[model samples]
Target: MKKIKTSPLLPQEFVVENISENEANIIAYPFEVGYAVSLAHPLRRFLLSSSQGYAPVAIKVEGAKHEFDSIRGMLEDISEFIINLKSIRFKLKNDETDAEVTYTFTGPKEIKGSDLSNEQVEIVTPDAFLATLNEDATLTFTLKIYQGIGFVPSEDIRDELDDGFIPLDAYFTPVRKATYEIDNVLVEDNPNFEKVIMNIVTDGQIGPVDAFKNALEVMYAQMAVFNSEISVAAPTTVERVDETPEIKKLMGRIEDLGLSARSFNCLDRSAVKFIGEIVMMSEADLKNVKNLGKKSYEEIVDKVAEYGFAVGADLSDEVVSAVKKKIEAE
Candidate 1:
């Protein structure tokens, strides 16, 4: 009969491959079964819905009272012109609040994003077409550029609009696309581990690598809401003193403990590098470390006991007594 392996493993590495300035592939490997999908789905949602960007939320065209109206000499009607405005991406240079941008063009000529005059805003898609005008005809318009996240319908901001301002559906997320795929990967002799391959594409306003990082940050912030302190009915507290001689000896490097790879990595990643630190942590605290399972926790407890120290024990008197006895024998 074959034995079953029950412990979980942390991903070995997270690598970002920049495919282009605005596209990237993020890879993480050696996750336990089903963990890849658990991580990738939420990240995909956050990347698509939480990224911030600027878009024209409202517009007022000269010679046009509403979207249904038409402007003379303009090749595109008011509705078509507004749709073109949605394609022009804006990047704010500073912390300025939302503001109105105006453009005036005379034809015979073609109008583009370059025709807009705004020092605080940069047109990322400057070559984007707006409309064309006939000879001696003039086109004028004002756009209310607003910074926001995800897709917001015009009706959501309708109450905030003033008279004659045509509300628009805003596409504010800079992430153009986000997707992920999972594949079976081998870890040691186990064939059930998985890997995640995520592809991200962003608009010119943000880089793909930056968008990936921001999505991770968003996921972290959302998870932090549930990272509250775990309360126990009777908590075991181990006070540590750095000045005592035996305690100082206990502060020796954790590497000397000869812990298993999984146990040692869990402690190292948790920043518990000293034997003193490990001795001070309760079983519950050790269990809280990412990927530290019950088996690894038991291994840590047994290894620490070999040194005549107990995890989460009141070591003030017991440690001093053990050190003195060992010194006398030496």
Candidate 2:
């Protein structure tokens, strides 16, 4: 550590290799140039440094523990992770060009709390309007992901988040966003759920299930087999799952058309089944699928009621407007 005196009381400790005045100022204070990652609480953050250009910079920070014994316990907990580390390579990033490292520390937050009632009831209704669309038309959509639902890399944390109000305080920002994309939208026909493919969008928006179902209209068609020169089977038989054995058998007879049986709850009925909870299926797909009947939906509600759950639906008004605009543009 090189001590450079900028002022009588403004001395700064800098890493060995880079003795630049800027680097000195950056590493001063309770921390050195690099960040320290201590698993313990009452966070004593560490400074990080990578003498070697292409290595991970090891962090040195204080342990979090209310008591001295607890501090020791925390040390023991992290001993394995820090044991072999003599120095970590400080890269511009985990794998990027060199840049100034910036960070801010937040204090032990009482973290605001909220009251939620799991005992509440929710009402959902099926989307008959969405179901009315042509089930045979292949619905192709370039889903515009709704806001507030994408993978925001962790290092993107704001430099002023914590403001480091409390001296020597440290924190670990939990990766908030899920790595997986929103509940998988049935962009393509999946074999398992063949008869009717459901391409539902669940991420980006949050709210009731029925509302969610109403917003999406995914077109589904069966796999078409080309007979080299011959055309396809009757388009009428495509994607429509038949309940009767005769209709189902007839679908198989249609060349290039693979009509298979599929079981699904009716639109309004099923929609009413999950009024409050978040459901992801688009309204059009639910209505297109056979068996989604008022009767079946009622049965679903009754069965669901038996488990002490309420029905519900949801869709974002903004999403509805946006989709409408998209259709207008088309």
Which segments of model 1 are wrong by more than 4 Å?
Answer: 1-7, 229-330
Leading candidate by TM-score:
1
Question: In model 2, where do residues sit more than 4 Å from their true spots?
Answer: 1-147, 160-243, 251-330
Cα RMSDs, all models: 12.7, 30.5
**How do the residues 245-282 of candidate 2 rate in per-residue lDDT, one tens digit apiece?**
42222222111221122212233333322222212234
Candidate 1 C-alpha lDDT tens digits along 1-330: 655656555575567899988889999887888999999999999999998888888988888888989988888899898888888888777875587877788899988876663787888788999888999789887788888899999999878998888999999999999999998986544688899999998878899888888888898788675557754344233222234566656756678789999889988888676676777678787779899999998888888888767788677676655543432221
TM-score of each: 0.67, 0.16
RMSD of 1: 12.7
